[model samples]
Target chain A: MENLDEKFNETIKMGLEIVKETEEDRLMTLSVGPQHPGSGHFRFTIKVDGDYIVYCDPDPGYVHRGEEKMCEYRNYIQNIPHLERPVIHDSTNITYSYSLAVEELTNIQVPLRGQYIRALASELNRQVYTLYWLGIYGIFLGHSTMFMWPLGDRELFIDLLEALTGARVTHAFNIPGGVRNDMPEGFKDRCLRQVAYFEKRLVEYEDIFYNNPLFRQRTEGVGILTKEDAIKLGVTGSVLRASGIPFDVRKAEPYDIYNEIDFKVQYMKTGDSFARSMVPFLDMRESCQIIRTLLDKMPQSGEVRAKLQPNPKGPAGESYKRVESGRGALGYYIVSDGTPKPYRVKLSVGSFRNILALPYLLIGSKLADMPSIYWSLNYWPVEADR
Target chain B: MSSNQSNTQNGSEQKEKVSESVQTSLSKKTETITLEFESSIVNHLVTRFTDKVVQVVYVRPGRTKILVPPNEIVQVATFLKDTLKFDHAESVSGTDYPKDNQIEVIYHLSSYSDEKLSSHVLALSTRVDRNDSRMPTLIDVFKSTEYHERETFEMLGVYFEGHPRNERFLLPEDWADIPPLRKEFRIKGR
Candidate 1:
């Protein structure tokens, strides 16, 4: 009886606390958005001293779909497509990598051909995501032309994805053993077209965004994180690489067809928004090369999903898998107890890593620069809140 | 970086590249392959290493898990930074191994050098006295431990000893009850 009351009291307290806001001295407490174009699906309570943010408390949970807990409740095989929902743009990469690791743990094998296809699809998605990030960062800095270019051009690949996977955003193609949909007919030509098309656009992107003085003024030296500080803050993905650490999991520890592909690990030493800008740009170029290589050199025929007696949950065990997402290195730590559902599931979301360091970084910067800094780092609120 | 290759007695020229161990600039490391390393032997090996004072403990297998006591964590982390030179903490994760009545804080550390690709993960583990749940703050050693530790404190209710600020890092301040991260903290009734 005492325990029940104690638990009940605790719940009520938590319920109230979630609604509470900071009482920072405010000339006017400006609410950024629940639907503002600046924020995707979240709100920020900023105490503004004229044009500068005196204090910024991010009001998350607007997009909290309970992604982590939902993963726990879902079955082993059911979780394949679900985990990718937060960052639907990078669906194949995160889902495929996670399924691969989980399959590895339960002693399932995805066939060599499947591995190559998975790699191919992931690389393709990486290019699309990079362009989207660049576009978002462009608009964040007030350049609409930069935003429209990539968003418009991104369709060609989306078409390629639709033809192959039957869905543009939710490419639940990856199954436990292998992909649900195999490469369709004429995919090679269409894929090659976009791949070649991107080859030309890659330089144009450099000319328009990277070389543009205005973009540099907004991005370059904006979020300068030193090598030591980058490590300290636990920043991952492009943010870490932008600090000039060539730590790409694909290169460091190869998974799928990464070992066979020959490509350079791209990084920028400046550790600023400009440096952050270069990551997706260079990455997209490298991905284009990888897609071409994988397509040209892929084996004629082999199995896709590994042969496993049963895809049922393995004995009580745990597995941690980190794969490069559009934002950074996304890790999924899953624990099982010989049951249908997971005993625990914790998503080490990529954007959340960059999001947590905001108060420290945004403390003294001008309020106007917040949007640029946010977009340049490429934080997806749904992914972060997940 | 020096690579140590042991000669194959039967040289069929099959070409299997095997190294006994590779040198990673001032530190010699052999891949553990999987997460499972015998705790007692690893402890013995830690004592044998010269130049650097560090300890590696296996927390769990199949998962990249490790465990380290607070006393050894500071020394080992310092050695990893100054001696072996792993300057980055990639992820700071917390686990409530309630069966063992212990909480594990895992720091995934890596080097900036290209030659050293495989991360040398060392687990820092301390079991809080269940009733008196407390462990010294690791924020002093690894600065990033502050946020992770606070999250752990909020979720698992594992008391952090001498934490610079025990204030909420993730959850709201006025929230009630102990953290909900403990493995045994059953949600059935709630």
Candidate 2:
């Protein structure tokens, strides 16, 4: 006390005040979903101080069926529809990937034309499904008419798909070596007509949704995932593409008959909700172009179905086949032990990664901003939950 | 990708720099890169733990199946997320090898990169003695593991230690004793 002068006494007082202010911070754990309307099927609890959610813990598996366990009991053929149900919107991707698994296990070749049609059907269904993402994006933003138009127009593509595979959502189209059916009568003509119709309607889609002020305001800069943040989170597909990564499975690691076709790969440099939303929307048109090339270039051949029964010789192998589903890089990791059924078939699902990215996107935003961010993502909860 | 991307020429000017310091280690390879790291080096990985041998098949290949012991399931999972850079849990699956009397619980981890897409699988496998059915809980590492571990525990009758919230995740919430995914859990038609 004797050594300290008036100046030293004031510095001590300032240090004491700093410690008092530091003690004012607070943390809380608020669970967001598993049932909440905005957060989807899984739940995430975020610890926060007012608006800034600091720690986000995602608790998924609300829909786990132990399907892999069930797959062991079911025969190889019976597993297609079961796998499709996990992410129902992209059935062709699942069926084709699974079919590749069975074929890779058995060592059979799907006929040339059959492979082309498989790619054609998958990409065609992709356009309609891409439209599905767009419609959901619109509805999430509260634009009822933009919601109705693309969805209503999407029926044209779905109708074409129905004629080819005899079902709407889960066609179970691709079998061990090839597709279940060939393109129906006048299918190419109808497909060409649908393409023209979409070309005309695309102007309206741009006018109503893309150019709309509300849609832009809601998504333009929301949920900005830095490229580094995305890579670290293990994000894939359009979400990663939007972050400016140019890697596309179609071009980088082509599967099916993709290497034979000539088409453009769509990407976005800005990693935001708007960029993420833009991907499937553009891929829809690119799908149309690919289908046009297929109609012109499809090889003239025999039956679409390949060796329709169990392989007699029992050859076993494994391959990680990937395709550009409307979403992103959809891959099937197949393992076989020379059996009719897969020894194990594992999938690296796309939507699961997309689903988890929401927390990083949601943290600082308001509760009201949830739907805009959620819908813009086009992530399916059952996909992650599975 | 264009010819520009395929080239390996070094021109160092970028808006976002790709470096060794980035959280999730990034790599781009020309082949279907398959690598086998020495166990001594692998033992030092973030996902590595005691009593478990973490073999990094490829630092970049994106697919891995960690060999784990029954009791140390929780420890390995904690090490993967907290120590290793594998931040997000992708999916959890179980496989019943009736022949071996052992069940494998696979935990898939997705990397957080806009860097590269890779998967790290941790397989916690143990023999189901039929007399004593028990395994450790991994819910602490991956919050999502609660349901996956519960369903496996229910249908396959594998027990989990310290399950935070263990209830049915797949079958109807009120349904009795696992609704049949195992070979022995008989269904009439099959």
Candidate 3:
């Protein structure tokens, strides 16, 4: 018995020494890859020390097709179709900024009715994008029901956009100087009814998803990005507003007819994963109100497009214009040297800016909180790469 | 018939004169307001760094441009961030002027804290020789510029001094060609 006790003590001492050695080199590197369902065509390498992430290196550009370089090869109008490809679901808003910049460069004044229609399409597209984001955020947190609900409701807006622009997604409806066509007959009443119904559905979302104890427990305070840190990191869109800064391009810059419309920029002061997710939901509600106002105030009858020469060229100048997309402030800087094709076109997307905050937020966070923290940044991978 | 034509011509002439006068006054009014805002910011910048500021132009009502020497970019950026409260860089874009043998890098700076300046975008630009394009980094001053500076380095081949990670970010790791945004780097069959 004495011999056995001595042997057991020796084994225990050896085991502790092995554990200490492993702890000294315990960081395990993980590649959340381009193939990851949660990562969405983007990859990041994270080194984990036990359960907490010790270091994070985000690797974007897997889907980069040189959109900026491609812009140089195409004419102004031809650029619209491909430019919107980066954020297809929010195509109108993406192209809206480009259109505004092009209009400024060429000195084309869009008629009042055209401006109203453009704003309407933009607001509708914002709803489509936020819903898609909300659905993905839902599934990322293992809420399968949420994934189905928002995506299913998104089809309603898609249908409206199809009616307005003739395509379901990638509606190349917005062009420089004006939209492609006027609103079809009886479209206003149809949009109003569908939007009103969509508002009711939002309450159900709050009950099932937002207020759910499980969702709240996983998301609330999981990744807290302080206001100071948020600004320093250059995050935008819902992420910035979530951090308690009420800066919206529509409110601040007011492109097109947005200045005339009355709507509140919904924001939260929590600056956590939950607040980031919730701000988009609140923005959708505000969007519904804006849509109603737009339809009510639209002119009775007017031209929707300005006549333009084929392969139109602008004088030598540069114009930068920004509009509030679902992700954030999307701006296009166009430099023209009195040519049909732009000399240089630079697209500054919100996702690229917001992704900068990932390393800042991911470090010192538990590995389990990765999805909640990452997706809550409202990052669309394709747009970021572009 | 001659009297009618002359009468119509006289009427058109008077209309043109009235419209021209109205247009001039309207433009003058806008110019005064623009000058007031432009002079305040431009004058302040010129006085602070008289020789560093190469040129100043009001791009539009809300957009302003300041061209500074490449060596003095960091100082101007620091002053803009600390004193002028241009807290963030919205975008950093580079244009290759191959004809001039220079590359122009523009930083579109804006503010969030100052409500009055929220709509304004101050473009702080600098030009460097295309052969050896190098400029100081603004990462220390505006933490938001980390990714933007890296992108400019990779895209335009403008080496940002003191940028910690000046590597291929958006491009493939094995990319051996010239920076893709350069005017000389053409797409296939273009």
Candidate 4:
């Protein structure tokens, strides 16, 4: 009877301990999870002291399909479909980097016209991606009209890409040697008209979203990532450029025909949320200019693709190539052991790098500023998780 | 009066010389140079740390690989950051060589601060034993390498010494099998 009484007392003590408070109890933990519309297939745990966030821990990989591991099983050509899936809206740029690395590995020279057409598709795809991001960013800030405008304008470019690649989202247009198809007949005039219309629409976006006093008040001085901190954190694309570093992969390390093309690297001196949001818009404007230049400079006629065996294999070597994708610098590091399948493949994405700055920026900020700060970093969670 | 005029002339000449030197140094810092196959950057790194660098080769015009011992990675990374101005790590990737019984970790280093070196990507790599994979972390030198190192650790089971967060990054909390990137860890139905 005494032993049973002692066991009951111990069980009660354990239950009491579970309810006891510790240092962590002072702060309430909230999960901005995948279910949350703002979080978007990613989650982060944050410790809040009332309205202020004290700690942030980003938990990615909810959408991780083990892309790097999957690359080993599939042959070079077969990898394109799934590889482009991570960032489907910006499919061309994702595969463009892979194709460049593969071509370097196999010594496949893309034809002159093929190079121009590839650049054209890449520019069109950039508009599609940025517009989508802008639309989502608008809804995040509670501006529904801001959401509608960019998405509606995005269809113009999407139509152009569909005509060129024969797919709406998953172009898989870029292959190892060259693009899957040449520009369709009348593609040039269609692209020019749409791009000109798109440029006019950009001005309206500035009026409604960017120049709004409410939008300016929320984002102007918030989540300031200084130049030094941005470099130390290794954030890329608009985030890096917004912090005053004019280091575009196209300009810094031009791949294929990017060296021949003349376009300015758009950047901002201020590294605040406002600057980060503005940089991508500026980049879209620059992309339009680039598309015009590429169209003008493209050769009149030439073969689009290089002939290759069904099972293409390269020498025992490795190659790393980077392309300026919509999100940022999407690079592929491929290792080949003279086989049809790659030994190892690593995709170094900008979204992954930019997400590192989240914890650093989110702490000490109000809960209301989370969406503005988070979306301004131009982070795409799926790509980061991949 | 003539002597005073001569002194002023000498002073102006010295001022011009100083400005010229400053201009030259500025140009040297920001000048965008084409990265040749046998570039001077590779030669400099090889010659500077001849003992630590096991092998060095030009993978392509802009990409160079420098292999160092696992033990001396921190030292080499520091030199690359401070002296060579390879400001940031673009990516940290690992490859498992089951035949060689080694797992190689490669840090693709590039520059943003120094425009002259911006075009070049210097891959600093080290190979550790597959079973007993442990290498000193470069996070102290390159702060941006923290997440990349964490990802590499969880994926490959390579322990990064001195790295605070080496736990599961991308993998699930209940991951029980071996690291997924390892050659032995096969994807089902392959």
- Which candidate achieves the best lDDT against the true structure? 3
List where candidate 3 sits over 4 angstroms from the true fold.
A1-24, B1-35, B51-54
For model 2, how does the per-residue alpha-carbon lDDT over A199-281 read when each residue is reduced to its tens digit? 78887788888888888888888778887766655566778788876656676646667788898777797888888888777
Candidate 3, position A95, lDDT: 96
Work out how many backbone clashes candidate 1 has: 6
What TM-score, to 2 decimal places, does chain A of model 4 have?
A: 0.94
TM-score winner between candidates 1 and 2: 1
Please provide TM-scores, in order, for all candidate models, with all chains considered together.
Answer: 0.79, 0.70, 0.92, 0.90
Pairs that collide, model 3: none
| Model 2 agreement with the true structure over B1-190: per-residue lDDT tens digits | 2533432232122101222212212233422243222121233442223222332322223333445666665656666666555555544555556787776666665444322333233333334444366666766566544444665676566667687645554455566754355556754565
Shares of reference contacts reproduced by the candidates, in order, are 0.33, 0.19, 0.73, 0.69
What tens digits encode model 3's per-residue C-alpha lDDT throughout B25-83? 12566655754554456545654655335466444567778799988888888888887
How does chain B score by TM in each prediction?
0.59, 0.62, 0.82, 0.79
* Model 1: per-residue Cα lDDT over A1-386, one tens digit each: 99999999999999989776656433467787769888787676766666766676665556655555566667877887778888788888778667865774565767888888888878878777777777777787888888999987788778887887899878987777777667887889989988888789878888887898987787777757787777777677888789888878787767767878899989989887788778878888888888899998887677766654544677676666677778887776666777867767767767777765565556566787787766766778877666
Q: Each candidate's DockQ score against the native complex?
A: 0.21, 0.12, 0.42, 0.33
Give the per-residue lDDT digits (tens) of candidate 3, residues A138-228.
9999999999999999999999999999999999999998999998989999999999999999999999999999999999998898888
lDDT of 4 at A344: 98
In model 1 chain B, the worst 10-residue window by lDDT is B17-26
Instruction: State the local distance difference test value for candidate 4.
Output: 0.88
Off by over 4 Å in 1: A1-36, A42-62, A307-311, B1-45, B48-64, B70-72, B97-102, B113-120, B129-131, B164-190
lDDT of 4 by residue, B131-188 (tens): 8999999999999999999999999989999998998878888999999999999999
Better model by TM-score: candidate 1 vs candidate 3 = 3
